[model samples]
Target: MTAPTTSRAARAALVLALLVTGLSMRTAVTSVGAVLDDLQDDLHASGGAAGLITTMPVLCFAAFGAATPRLARALGPHRLLVVALAVTTVGLATRPFAGGVALFVVVSTAALAGSAVSNVLMPSLVKLHFPDRIGTMTALYTTALAVGVTAAAGLTVPIGEAGDGWRQGLAAWAVVSAVAVVPWLPTVAADRRARATTLAGPVAPTGPDAAGSAAPPARAVPMSALLRSRTAWALTVFFGTQSMQAYITFGWFARFLTDHGIESGTAGAMLAVLTALSIPVSLVVPRIPARHHRAVVGLFVVCLATAYVLMAAAPRPTAWIWVVLAGVGGGSFPLLLTLLGMRARTADTIATLSAFVQAIGYLIAGTGPLLFGALYGVTGSWALPIAVLFTALGVMTVASRRSTTPRFVDDELAASPR
Candidate 1:
């Protein structure tokens, strides 16, 4: 089915909303990594507490993202996103003022909570508004996401150094989140009008019955039924493992470089390079035909595994090389995001599948940084953390074998006897 007829202004507003929302999502998480040491020093946080800070994003995302479908159904996606962005702005602006480690985590969780909702809703919004243009829209927003990740990683240290400290750098993102809320506000009104139009219009179901009359409305697949599908499970594993690697990269890659005797600013720059590469890769990867996804996934796994080995073994001497490899591997993120749209037919199904994938995927991702920090605290090195990434890559490889196949959740549900 085509998107509901929208005024040009409404379309423009939606595009801006998607771009800025993508830009705002990662700043809360990545900004901290560049100034982590100073923040830890100020808070007098232990290594375990520091690990928890990095882990908080995924934890909050898992918790809040699971509820987004329900929230969107009741409030509408655009209106809910306006609330999410406002919460994000408030959380980002205030968290920097928290006095101790615990308060900081609490406030940061609030910020991540907002990001979590935005993250899950983006795919559903794209599917709803641009059903035939999924690849293009996914690339546009994911590229914007990469830009945000790169800017936050590369500039945070310098921003911190220029101001009072890490607080200034971290809080600066609140302004961007505030700006993102504007586009969404207009879209909320547009959404109401669109819904009214949909309700008032005649229902022309897509297919007919054997007697040649119009068919009934397609039923949305429930989340519980997804648990029984191998494809859903595989996609979940694929998304989880890739996110684990990504969170590790954002949370610790800068610190890893600094620990290896690289300057902090240079380390942040390397991390920036890693994220910046994803912009182009995100654009290109989503456009690649699904037939090539397995080969692409294999290539990404190789680059990621090799980067981990190099970083663990000889981080300083060839750090840039590792960053390049890892950045290329990070393309898997956009790949999986594209699949969220591809694997489902209707927007409702996309929302359900997207939530199912991200909610659980992030739970699995949350463990990466926590375990990375725990092992580094215990072993006094990065080797074990890198080893854990290697193990995740293996799991991702196995999972992608089924996930990358061309299939739809709607079809799977129709075939199920239950």
Candidate 2:
């Protein structure tokens, strides 16, 4: 079915809401990491215990995101996202008061679940609301997400100074999430109307005959078909590998720099630069036409390889060079997100494929740091893990090429003889 055209103002409003929603999603997790050292000192937690705090977002993302589509199907995306924002707000605000690690983890898990739902749903939201402007909207929200993370990391410590310490600093993001929910009130109203219409009668269920008359758009491709597609598996693996690299870099890059004799403050600044660099690249890459994906991804991979080589050979003096190259390599994060929409024809497919990719992908990703960290512990050198990252990037480049090929997920599934 043809999508109803939204007025420019309404479209702009939706984009604003999406930007706020995207901002709300990542800050809760990153802010926690910004203050992790303080939390560890306060709780007297072991390195493993402290690491879990940073890592919990990935676990919650995979677990909760695996189930988000089911929830979105039942509640509808806008209403569900509103509920997610509410949960995120409550979780962030309340976790600071938890006096111990166990309670903190529980509350943080709850918060991250909310963020996970938002993360998985954003692409589908973009698909549904801004089909014609997928690249633009994706870039806008991605840019906001990048800025949100940078701001939280840069400012949280100063914010925390007004209160007891890191706990209060961490809790400050509750304001961001809380404020984000405001723009969604209009969206929730619209979702209620749509849900009402959907429930009012037989809902004009779609069929093979949908194109001729009053059948709903051909029943959304079953998730089962998506599961059978070679394209789907390739994209999912691509997403997983990129996420593994992303999570590892976010969680451990600073420590690696410090270990190499950089001061902690300078290391943190370098890591921030790596993250900040992704913002412009994220905005620009998605806006490029599909034909160029291979060249773009190829260049970024080459840059990443160069960075890895530098780190292995002359990590200290050339650290800036490595940081810049590594940031571009990580551009795959947004590029993959853009493909989720660019790839799927129907909003249902976008939503389901997103849930499937991220759910499975993050579970795979969540293991990267632990596995590599364990390898480091056993071998006592950075070479082994760096080599492992090289292997992941090699495989990721292959999968990314397959995912970027100009084919729609729905088209692939429909062409199946089965």
Question: Which candidate number would show the highest lDDT if scored against the true structure?
Answer: 1
Q: Write the per-residue lDDT of candidate 2 for residues 1-418, one digit (tens) a residue.
A: 2233568877677878988887777988788777887888787778878878877887888889877777776786778888999999999999987878888889998899999998888988887777667777888888888888888888888889977788888888999888888877776666655653221111221222122223234444545677878878888899888888887788778888998999999998899899999888878987877778889899889998999899899999999999989988888888888888777665666777888898888888888888878888999889998987898899899998889886666666766877
Model 1 Cα shift for residue 319 (angstroms) = 3.6
> How do the residues 1-418 of candidate 1 rate in per-residue lDDT, one tens digit apiece?
2255788888887788888988998999889876888899999999889878876777788889888877776676777788999999999999999999999988898899899988888887887776666777888899989889888877777777899878998999999899999877766775565542111111222211112233235454557778867778888999999888887887788788888889988886787777789989988997777678889999998998888888777888989999999999989999899888777656766777888898899889878877987899999977788898898889999999888887776666667787
Colliding residue pairs in candidate 1? none
Question: Which runs of model 1 end up more than 4 angstroms from their true locations?
Answer: 1-3, 44-46, 160-163, 190-221, 254-266, 308-318, 373-384
Candidate 1, residue 160: CA error in Å? 4.1
List runs of model 2 lying over 4 Å from the truth.
1-5, 196-216
Task: Choose the strongest candidate by TM-score.
Answer: 2
